[model samples]
Target: MPNNSNENSPPKVSRQILRFLVIGGSSVAIDGICYALITTWSGISPDVAKGISYVCGMLFGFWGNKVWTFESTKRSVSEPIFYVLIYACTLGLNVGINRAVLLLAGDEFRLLGFFLATGTTTVANFVGMKFLAFREQLPADSTTSAPSSEPPEVAIPVSDRRAA
Candidate 1:
């Protein structure tokens, strides 16, 4: 029974990572679609359209990560502020890397540059969120207990001690 209980423990960190990846992927798709539509239909510059789309995507990513991925229901004023700060920092990094890639790869292969930039940013964001944004929730619960440091002593047979 005890062993069975241990087997049922939830895999916390892996589950959290998987959830974050899934949500982040969805948010990126949303951002890309929004940026494409705005640039194509509204005659907006790609940069402006990307900025607007990023903000929308950031909002989706924040709520998705905060509530679903981290299971963090703490909604104090500071929460949003901290999240926004992180988003802004990541966004700046993303844009810088994207521009650098474009410059290096040349205008002819700008699309490839953008893809590489996005991939890099995705990995960076995942690491940042795991370590910085959600490091508070450590030592997740498990059913199994660790063995005690003290050595166990031999015990007399119960029947021998009682009757003999």
Candidate 2:
């Protein structure tokens, strides 16, 4: 049988990915604006400025991804810890890539370096958060139910039953 409803609807994974991308776009904007502001107004180095902006972006990203992107309700103590660890990796990647670009070619183009670095981490962040960080936790009710102890009643065919 053809599933017309399914044909009209996008796959769940695709929808989640789309939502994630939307959230990421906003995070990037936040990150870029803050990076520009901090670098423009302060004496801080680009690397340091970017670091601060990146963390701010991550904070927004975390909330957006948790509340809207993934639609997760149950909270686990370990998830936040895990999220921090994953962002730690992402932070290193973003900072390292941006600094490397600035050192090599984008010194005059700070935003360019920022974009290049942000591009590098976007997918990793999504995958990590989708699969690990904010994945839904199912309670026992949502999974297999507890087994029942009662035995099933059996009926015998009239032809097979004896006098009884």
Candidate 3:
């Protein structure tokens, strides 16, 4: 189990990083497979296929990071809205990177361009998701109460005490 306290501390940060990496790997697989299937099976423009795959990946990324990576349970009417904001920013950056890479690398290396775009956007997404969008909140019970570090005192029943 990862420590939920001190997210900035080395150990907890490392845990978060590890969990983020796991979720990132899953998102990559989902995006890659969906993109391939959509492009191969459908006659739609590659841009359209890419957009659909990106949306699917974005939704999965949001849910996976919220529940598993951050274990976030904080509730607010604006959370989804905040998520949209992050999505838009990251998506725009990703698209920009893709176009730039394609232009620089040439169409013959399209796959490389795609990978570069994905890699850059993924790093940005992780940073935003970790620090802003779904920042971890302390467990609900932690706010109102504090647990003692000392061992808890337990009262023995009268009969058990006599036996001793």
Q: Which candidate number has the best TM-score?
A: 3
The TM-scores, one per candidate, come to 0.57, 0.59, 0.60
* Model 1 CA deviation exceeding 4 Å by range: 1-11, 29-55, 137-164
For residues 39-146, could you state the per-residue lDDT of candidate 3 as single tens digits? 999998999999899778877877887888877887775556777787789789988888887888788878887888888877887788777888766554564357
Model 3 segments more than 4 A misplaced: 1-5, 28-57, 137-164
Q: Each prediction's Cα lDDT score?
A: 0.74, 0.81, 0.79
List of clashing residue pairs for candidate 1: none
Clashing pairs in 3: none
**Quick one: best lDDT, which candidate?**
2
Worst 10 residues of 1 by lDDT: 1-10
lDDT of 1 by residue, 1-164 (tens): 23343221368667877898899888889899999889889978889999999888888998888888877755567656767677677678878877887788778877886777677777777666655665443233442346558785578898888775
For residue 162, what is the lDDT in candidate 1? 75
The window of 10 residues in a row where model 3 has the poorest summed lDDT is 136-145
